[model samples]
Target: MKLPYALAKRFVAGESLDQAVPKVADLNEHGIKVTLDLLGENVKDRKTADDTLQHYIELLEGIHAQNIDSSISIKLTMLGLDIDRDYCRNNLFELLDAAVKFNQFIRIDMEGTDYTQATIDLYKEAFKKYGKHVGIVIQAYLHRTKNDIADLAELGADVRLCKGAYNEPERLALQNMDAIREAYKEYLKVLLDKTVYPRIATHDNKLISWVKEYTQEKGIGKSRFEFQMLYGMRLNTCKALAAEGYNVRVYVPYGTMWFPYFTRRLKERKENIWFVLSTMFQK
Candidate 1:
């Protein structure tokens, strides 16, 4: 069944880049930075991958031309990572090249456990070639995150740490909420100590408070790191952080392929599911 456009719009910006930029501008007007993500993933064909690449390039061009204070995030599978490593790398290089040309940034988003290692390898290769304009995300729920963070830290790579959203087997991912939260804290400490600018992305108030206290104790000013939240999840919290003078970036996802992303988000938060059901039955 197709999801109602109104229901999905709570999370997705719209079906096209043109519809999305005004949203980015609105967030920027509220003193929040933006990270635009095209909502397709796991492309199985080269044509789709190539099209995704061009869309990203055009998105970057629009961002630069409009003078929007925003960056972009992309999934490797959308760029043909599953098709061929070399092909995927070349596609990424094109996007990174465009980002460099525009003096902007691109973040390689991490997917499931299966793609973790390959994604990291691609990110390292891209970062080595593209330099400061490229970055990657790390999921704290993964048992290997500490070591991965250490490796990225040694390279002085840009990192965004999130308490992952995917469901995984017990063998590969932490199943306990407390365990994931603790891992998030430890991973963040390592990131703050070694990485130049780590993005802390979470909605937990305890974690948010802890990050503030921890950074203050370590004498890390607000500028050394940033706080990130999804586009529609916690607008007030994001606004509050921005008001407190911390760099806050809103992760805004948009595209016609939004069902998978929307369903995953609904599973992550029961309240969101309830909101949809409630809205569906509204007068």
Candidate 2:
């Protein structure tokens, strides 16, 4: 593996849980919460998926034992969604049992368009049983996300809304920036109006400012929802929001199978490329 150790250090906590603890603690010290995502997905076999399930249970135990103020994010494929839906769901339920035990929360991370509906289906199934401790993410670029958000709103689901990271086709996703942002505006209203403590995930300054203004105009308290950003992208903004008494959470990802997540990070933002190059030269 051609590990871009520099970028990995920037975006991922580490390749192991032992290396992630301090990172999480530092964010907590700064008054920001965390949602730890163990970076692995699209598992093709049962043993690996089963191992993933077990590792998550261990992760929960470890976080609880360390007294970490962090929740976790899960990708269903990591738990075998691509292999079998029922098997994946069973794994999710088992992990939710651990979440219940520790009184921690788990947010299901949304993948590409192909996995969207099945992800939601499994999430709803999990929510029906362990709704209090489970949540899901939705992408703003997709045309179907409007309906997805409506369903989540009705369910009063705790959702994380992002502008999407997948390279979706034009027919299925909003290709123009203006169209995507407009869709985000409508989605935000529904999320704030009906969802339970939605997390708005974006690094766009205008969108961030707009969310502050929109929520304020609607009389929504700062504690009503959260502003979520990737772990290494916006520490200053996260701290500023925290200082302002707004709920802010950082999505901290770490694991040995981190290459996929790492590449996704670089592709998600042009700034990430510059971030890597700038930091590389600095070193």
Candidate 3:
């Protein structure tokens, strides 16, 4: 026997905003913030893109109504980046407008290599117009990340640095584990030194320890930066960090398009699949 996807529902809030809202509210009660993500990508048409933007608008409104302490993370492709750049930009602006109305923030999530430049371009446009209300993600595994960080720093953008999930060629990305970790640490230093508020997104315990020590050594206050972890992957670690009075945000993704996202998680950490399977077989 193997664990059904339904069993993993404990990890995913649900497939809709209605289902996710309560879960996020509960996390807030425990003193943990959330970055809510409506999980879908690479929309094929303008209609779908508009619909996605509307869904986010409703999500923002729901969060506002509930008085939840959370922000929304969005993927450009879900806003029609692949269909048309201007169209995508327009869709993003709609969501940004909603965020502005609610006095909330929108985090632009980084995708694969093909969309990298466009994503950065969109972030630049948004940051210029909205400033701190917008933030972007940086993938440490990418070879160009150093330059990317430097450019983003010049804009004083808020950035979340993550060990990338996408698989890429050696020329474009760091394939070695140690190399990626080293790059992550270096990038962390650059972001912390230059950006307004940088986010370190990782689940590796050793790296988390290193970051705690480095930030303290650099005299960076716990409020200046945050540690981000995916929902359910490391609940205890997240709680411990929160208990220590450090900012910790859990990335909570919800939508019907969870298969691709779930598969990506499995591919990144194959052991997770075994854990799922074992859970399914348990009496």
Candidate 4:
């Protein structure tokens, strides 16, 4: 008989904070920083959003108590974006307040295009009040990202750049892989030239090489910016970068609603599905 998806748990830490805490500690020991993400999105009710907020409050406490060098990232939908804007904003502030108490930063993870503008708006509001304690993500595949980077750089806000995983329409996103990679490189250059403390989040070896060369040519120190990669996908690459004395942070996601997140990761790279299947058959 085939094993259930539960048996294929190696990809995710688990559905609880307790399951993820040790993983964060281990990564810190390896000299890799972490950004802990509690996975879930498009919450349907205030009760659900409130519950998620409470969990994040507890996560903030746990991180401080463990003395682990990790930050938390959250999606607006998980905080009730679909229900009401004020509700979402208030919930976000609640988490931000908790983050402030712990002297930790909270990154607002970018979602699909529908929530992009609202997320930026909320990020700006929080940033105006508490500057470096918060950050936001921008997707390079979007047509407007170049301008967005310029605007974000103006605020001196921390930005995390990703290749975007949502299935967006061609009009709104780059449809070709080469074009997307070109856009990624271009946007990264713009960020490095314009912003401070930008996070280069990618798993592509070629792109990583380009970042290294471009930053070195510009005399940007490794401490001025950091490279970020997904938790389980590029361990060797992350380790190599850190060993070379560059700062690197892993995007560590955990929580119960992992199916959607895992599916998106699989869709990003078909080989990932093959890897999961192979692991399922192994001891």
Clashes of 2: 0
State which candidate, 3 or 4, has the greater lDDT. 3
Model 1, runs deviating above 4 Å: 281-283
Q: What's the lDDT for residue 226 in model 4?
A: 94
Across residues 161-225, which tens digit of lDDT does each residue of candidate 4 receive?
A: 99898999988999888888899988777777778888999998888998889889989898888
lDDT of 1 by residue, 56-126 (tens): 99999888888888899999999998899999999999999898899989999999988999999999998
Q: Which scores better on TM-score, 1 or 4?
A: 1
Number of the top-ranking candidate, with lDDT as the measure: 1
lDDT score of residue 8 within candidate 1: 85
C-alpha displacement of 157 in model 2, angstroms?
1.0
Q: Which model, 2 or 4, shows the larger lDDT?
A: 2
Q: Write the per-residue lDDT of candidate 3 for residues 74-136, one digit (tens) a residue.
A: 999999999999989988887888888999999999999999999999999998888778999
How close is every model to the real structure, measured as TM-score?
Answer: 0.97, 0.97, 0.96, 0.96
- On the 0 to 100 scale, the lDDT of residue 212 in model 4 is 89
Clashing pairs in 1: none
